[model samples]
Target: MPSLTAVCRVHALLDDSGSVGVTAIDKRPVDGPVEVKRLGVRGDVQASRAHHGGPDKAVYAYADSDAEHFAGILGYEVTPGLFGENLRVDGLDVTGAVIGERWAVGETLVLQVTMPRTPCATFARRLGESGWVKRFQAEGRPGAYLSIVKAGPIRAGDPIEVVSRPAHGVTIGDVFAGLEPEQASKLLASPAPRLSEIVHGLAEKALTRAAVGA
Candidate 1:
């Protein structure tokens, strides 16, 4: 079991301060319990809704271990919410968490693992590091995106308990591994309804690649 170490959110900004204009990558920690809904954390605003904050990606979760790994690489201490993640969890292998896996946060809120967070230009600019997108991709520890299964309040220090796990072993890391055809097939065939759409998209990509090979 893991614990929620921090909860965060941010308001959208229109200024072109960072490399990405009109962004809300600057997330700050919020005190006490915060409401989690289908859209996202209450008060959290996504400037680029096209790429973030939808039903499938209602919440972003990152592991403390991953932050530590990045800290060792970047030579700076990475704090919770600094990566714009809505939840900072401790003692969870988020990369290894299977898609469609259900987690009970606190006593009421339930969340299902959806997809992995792919690094974007905004993420690179947040780090002020060049080639960060490539570096992050190569690292292959992209955090997990979660969809609210049972909307409720989540707060720091809430226990995260695994409620269910899909039989398919298509973990977030596997998706970050370029969604191989085999894994994609398994995910697509999974009985978990929450994973259907995501796996379908991956399966389509696999088909395209196979067609090209043919």
Candidate 2:
């Protein structure tokens, strides 16, 4: 069954003047239940509200399998929260999950898949890998960012249920890269709520460019 292997939270606030002035990208696995609020997990703060956090991106969820794939390429053990994910899920098609999909985590917390993460300069610096952003973008495995639909407590080893999936067929991976104009049209036409503004804007741009070129 799909479940949360690790529930992580901001472990430290490190200087990242290049992007956000200060960063809270050092997420570490936390013991016990962590309260998930409307904006994000409790005790966690986003460094850049302009680009990183808000109601649309309350929590970031990554597939552990995807992390393992990166581990193979990076030549290092990819631990839970190493990529700054609040929840490391296993046995789930995270990137393939359609936008507006709703996940029932543990008991009460409900989250809706909203958008795919875009790697930042701080993320690259945190990874200590040269050409990391391009590399990450090329691989196109950026995890899904979810909006908190129902705030509650979440802990490690909690069960994750994909309670709903929209028929739009716009997966997190598709939105991240390799999106065609038709797919972009479908995404924009989706009636499901809580889709992020970034995603909507991307679809609009792609559709408009396609229309102009036609």
Candidate 3:
């Protein structure tokens, strides 16, 4: 069964990475059930709401499989909250989750898969690895940001049910790795409301580049 392996929240902010004075990337797992609101998991706050948290990015999830893969490369254990994700999912392809896919978390909370996370310098700083940003980007399993549709309490070990998905079939992996021209066309034409400005820009760029080269 696909389940929420961990529920993480920010307890303290990490010192500035560069220009940003602080980072909320250092998240830790909580003991029991936690409330999930429209903004995000309760008690978890980003240092920069301007660049980070928003309605379309209310929650973030990273799959355990991806974390396991990273742990091998990093030569260290990638714990539940290491990636600063609000939910750590087990037995699910979160990276490949289709845009506009609706998930029923536990029972009450409903979430819509929005977009893939773009690696940032703060994320690199969190890893403290050389070329971490590019490396993460290259891996192309950056996980998925989610929009809260129905807010309620969620917890570790809660079952995850994918309730619906847009018919377009464009997945988060395709967007994160850069879509092909055909894939971009599908994404652009899809009426799914979950595609954010960033997602639109990426698809549009793909088409523009294809046209220029034609």
Candidate 4:
């Protein structure tokens, strides 16, 4: 694949479906660069399932795996899907990433893998259907949720590079694959304060289940 390139620009648009539904409205595919929008830096975008309002931390977009993949599968460069990404990397193997791994976008933007995205209520609404969350959970393709370690401006076409790998050899994908909400509670009761709140919550819930079984 291509090594790296500069992020040309960034763009944002309103979800015309009144509820920020999915569907490709504006994108460039032929003979030029495509447009990628930021998902959660605004007051309107939130993680809550209620249609209220919140910051847009996770952004969902259509798949653009390869030129052929887009053309054959998605029919375009930017199809409407679900993504909780701060930056829509053009050519990064995003799903293959592990937790605690670090990657730099452009030059100043650095991010660490915090968690794999769990589908929320708004996502189902956006997809105009239900049970989509179960589909993700079943397949283990929950995508990546990142924590911004160094805040920086990001844009489309920006080059991304891995700066660090996970120390535990556990990837973000693995955590998502293993997470059990009920059992996550016990993980929180433990003394591992160094873990992120979400991670601890998942572990604690799993631990609770184990205790009950024991």
Candidate 5:
């Protein structure tokens, strides 16, 4: 099977909350090719960190991962647009994926697509674009949340592969779709262990409450 490769990895910085520019965090820009940098696990990007974007957050570009056939989702398409993703993956059809699905990137990192990324107020306000959150909710294409199994540096041209599938048949999309406290708990309590202990504990509490109600 063909593997997913990283086409572009972009990091944006904000100057005191307004000026947003894409730059190389590590290596310098070279002739025709932007120098891809070696970003550490939790190094801070001044602009991004100042703007509240995670230090390790990066936008990744993938060649193919969209299931929609007719029209490609346009930039400014969803709430955050093409540039909103911390890691933009071209070949990952992660929109409707389930929990416990394992993906391997370049043999150095293993990430379990744990949950769907919800739109936060910061995202809406930062973008300052109208209908941002509504657009993403309408399409139900929320990107997946990654819990890093193995930490390592990633650059452009890295490949992504699906090493394992979720046994429960529920997708990551299902986990986030109208996920009430009870449902979230059930998913976490399932045979397949949750990727994050924090999430698992939250689920357990929710399950306890649900049991009390029952």
Candidate 6:
């Protein structure tokens, strides 16, 4: 069982040099319990709704182990929330987390794993590193994005409970690596109650693309 080591948030603001004209990628640690809602954590903002936020990506979680891996490579201390994650969890195999897996945060909040965080140019600019997106992809430890299944409050040091795990066995990393039609089909056909319709649609899209050799 993993523990929530830190909670973080940031306001949306303009970044002239970023790939995205504006971003909320500069998150910092927040103390005490914070409200969790359908859209996202209270006070947290996403400048680009199309690529971030909404029901499917309400919360982003990254494992401390993953951060440490980056820190070793980047040659700097990569603290919690530095990567714009809402939660910094310790001992969670974020890359290996299966899609549709549900985790209970503290006593109330329920979150379902949805997808992996795809590195973009905005992330690169935040790190002030060139080819960072490519480097991150090669590292293959993209964190997990979660959807609020049951809204409540979450705080640092909260214990995480695995309420359910989908049997599909497709991990967040698998999706990041680009799922094949067969792999996508298995996930779409899963009996997991936490699996969202949006995920099904994505699997269908992948199947279509595979069929067309796209």
lDDT, candidates in the order shown: 0.87, 0.89, 0.90, 0.47, 0.49, 0.88
Q: What are the per-residue Cα lDDT tens digits for candidate 3 across 43-141? A: 889898777999888989999999999999999999998988999999999887998899999979999998999889899888889999999999888
Question: Which candidate comes out best when scored by lDDT?
Answer: 3
Pairs of residues at least 3 apart in sequence or in different chains that clash in candidate 1 = none
lDDT per residue as tens, model 6, 46-83: 87787888898999999999999999999999998889
Question: Candidate 2 lDDT, tens digit per residue, 49-144?
Answer: 888779898899999899999999999999988998989999998889989999999999999999999998888999999999999999889998
Query: Is 2 or 4 the stronger prediction by lDDT?
Result: 2
The TM-score of candidate 5 is 0.61
Q: Candidate 4, after superposition: displacement of residue 95 in Å?
A: 3.0
Local accuracy of candidate 1 as per-residue lDDT tens digits, 1-214: 6999999898456465543467887787899989999888999998877787889989999999999999999999889888889999999999999888999999899999989998988888778898999999999889999998899998999999988998888889988887777777787677665563665687679867977988
Sorting all predicted structures by lDDT, with the top scorer first, yields 3, 2, 6, 1, 5, 4
- Candidate 2: residue pairs that collide: none
- Candidate 3 C-alpha error for residue 91, in Å: 0.4
Q: In model 1, where do residues sit more than 4 Å from their true spots?
A: 11-14, 17-20, 196-198
Write the number of the candidate with greater lDDT, choosing between 1 and 2. Answer: 2
Which candidate leads in TM-score? 2
Residue runs of model 5 more than 4 Å from their true location after superposition: 1-12, 15-82, 180-186, 195-214
Backbone clashes in candidate 1 total 0
104-125 per-residue lDDT for model 4 (tens digits): 7655756566566666654555
Q: Candidate 4, which ten residues in sequence have the lowest lDDT sum?
A: 52-61
lDDT tens readout by residue for model 5, 89-129: 55567765556677677647666666666665445555466
Model 3 stretches with alpha carbons more than 4 Å out:
none
Q: In model 6, what is the error at residue 188, expressed in angstroms?
A: 1.8
